[model samples]
Target: MPPVSQAPNPTPLYPWGVPPSPPEKSRVGLMAGIIGGVFLLIVALLATLVLVGKKIDSSYPPAESTLTAPGTLLDGHYKLAKDDSPTLGPSLEKSWRLSWDAKAVHGVVVAYHPSGGDRGELIVTGMYGRFRNTGEVRSRVLAGNGSRHTEVKVIVAPMDVTPSGSRIRVSCEEVTRSWADGKALSYPVCAWADGNTWARVAYMTVYTARSLDLESAARITLQIRSEMVKPIK
Candidate 1:
């Protein structure tokens, strides 16, 4: 009889299924966790970038070698000829041109110069014994400023012949660097092949007064290859 007093509809406990609100502390803790995770991810990414940058900076060609010795000038004319011999190596089978401009600069010793005619778009240089068939050979060809730097360096026995039969290995470290004036920039590509045989070539402006863009340098390099010369003997 007491309960019969209109049970008040049992107050419908929690308004039929509405879940209770989460605690403020719990919500704050979840937000903090998300923020902390994001912060850690950013820190990790930054650390990786720093490490990669350091590696690249250290790997660039060293500049000290450039300022040491003044390179010898090779301001002479040359001629080209055709080479169809099978034993001359693929590099020489193209057109072969030869010039004698023995010079020394920046510790780089030059042996031969090729103004390419049919040798492909490349210039091959023979370095000193540093590139002799034994130690190491560093050689390079610069097409121009901002152009691709092609270098050939190797370490081998004292009398071994290089892949191109150009030079032997001694000790070599080849590199290509850039220089600029107000109008245009120049790239000097240098390499050391065998002893007493080094090579250096630059794709520079035909006329120093004019701008020597990258395209021009590339074209010049191609011309040198097309007119490359080799020793027939």
Candidate 2:
């Protein structure tokens, strides 16, 4: 009997010609890893921001100091005398005598009574008598070292005195702009007050400027308030 011819073994297929197994499982795992990494990164960044905000909050202290000087009275009776310019410029020059009744209205009185003006122009023209019963006033707060000084921006609100009584309350907001740091800063001593015939008082808040510290701002505010006196009544 003729030996049955063995069927030629099928040639092994080349691996290169075979379709590769789909990497579906690996792809799934890789995606999961990428997503987890992004989530973790975001959480870390948020935590960092929280820590930074807390640090800033902790830096400023409360403003408890009273601005009213002892023995100072605000009963609407006093005199104003013109004084030489403290710093030389075009600003009107004047001082005060305790005898004048601080109620009479004058152009200078009306001008400085409100809370807006140019520093150079303020020196020359005095304060403008725009009389802002509403809106806000911008004031300067002093900060930084003696050699390197900075200005802090402050906002003051007008008060309602009454018919025949001239009374205004200036409130300082915690928000502040800085000339030195080129950024806005906030502080805890965020509130301050100056009313007619009353001591100026400052209230602290929970924020402060990065460049212009709260203390510096308060000092500058005090100086500005001191310069302000109502015309003799």
Candidate 3:
């Protein structure tokens, strides 16, 4: 009656010196935790993007940015001076003031510095013309603005850079004109017109050595003519 020889402690065998495998429960928990962490991280990233997008969207002008005073603002081309590139420079605060008279519509947008001052103006004017062509409208604009301001240097001629399928023509010139900021700003007055109306888009870009592609102006006016004016019978 000797003590029964105890069987050797039967632990799972490993091929080499590999550690024992983790329990199934532990492994499952680890996988779950990893998956949960990844899900949460993705959600956080999406939420952050949404928040940022909302903030950016909220930057829009509180009130519909008015164009200089009161008349028919030809409906067609969207915002010329956006909060984006090219049209919008390095300024912060800006708005387009709209106003018009009997036969015309005007738009004036200005970007201002944070410190308090003016940046420049992106202006558009739409004038109602029953059966006038681009040349007539262009001539009228030139004569009116010229008579009003004497400071100018002929840089660009009233070229026929009109848009395709549009009777609008593009005309640009270099001049120093008075702005709302009470300063004489220099820029090229680019304008375009069709059979129905004429529009101008101006920026404080002085040109002495070169010219600008007034196609944008023409395109804008073209849209206006297409949308606002009815086709002739």
Candidate 4:
């Protein structure tokens, strides 16, 4: 019998007759790796943000059980007068009332005349309450400043202040507004918040020559807040 003809060897598709992975499979693997990497990165970022938030929350000032009126602050440079007048005008008061909670703890409007015979005054209008949202309240107070007044010129935009104790968050502004006497006067205004207590301060004077810078105004606010707000026992 004739020997069976051997089948001709087929041409090898690759060097060792083994083909590489398909292009589609390789693409799928690459995409999976990229997606996995992105997922991990996002998770890491979120974890970091959480850690930072926790740290910030821990560093905040201790919560107070109630608000206080210390009557005076800054070594008697400021005095909480018995007569709480409407020094900030009706429109601003209305805005504050709308922004703050109705059942707030302590609300007051007092003017601090220069302990000496000076003609300038610092008006502090504020209230203490549990703020549902501290940041929103602060922003609203800042934005609503001089809202209905057309003759107001902003001299210093709102800015944050870090006082010595780090017990409060303070923002300040400076503006020139037309007075009822047909003259323009500059005012240094500041807002203070500590998640529980909030205040608005305005330094006003008819003596245009005497001026208080925004830094001074912020410092004054810090002193006032430190004196007025006390941590619960």
Per lDDT, the best of the predicted structures is: 4
Write the residue-wise lDDT of candidate 3 on 69-166 in tens digits: 12232341123343232243222112112212112223323321111233444455444323233476576565555654555444555556566765
On the 0 to 100 scale, the lDDT of residue 127 in model 1 is 24
Which segments of candidate 2 are over 4 A away from where they belong?
1-24, 63-233
Q: Rank by lDDT, highest first.
A: 4, 3, 1, 2
Q: Count the backbone clashes (under 3 Å) in each candidate.
A: 53, 28, 11, 0
Per-residue lDDT of 21-127 in model 1, one digit per residue for the tens?
Answer: 88567778899999999999999999999999777545433222121111212233322223222233333212112221212322221223234332222233422
Give every collision pair in model 4: none
All candidates' TM-scores? 0.26, 0.26, 0.37, 0.58
lDDT of each: 0.33, 0.33, 0.47, 0.67
For residues 1-233, what per-residue lDDT tens digits would candidate 4 score against the true structure?
Answer: 99999999987768576776666557788899999999999999999999997775555444564446566667886566543634533433455555433223456567666665657666677766555455566655666677756777777788776556665667877788886789877777888766677777777755422566666777877877767777667
| Model 1: lowest-lDDT 10 consecutive positions | 64-73
Residue 181's C-alpha lDDT in candidate 4? 82
Clashes of 3: 11
CA lDDT, candidate 3, residue 178: 57
Candidates sorted on TM-score, descending: 4, 3, 1, 2
Local error of candidate 4 at residue 232 (angstroms): 5.5
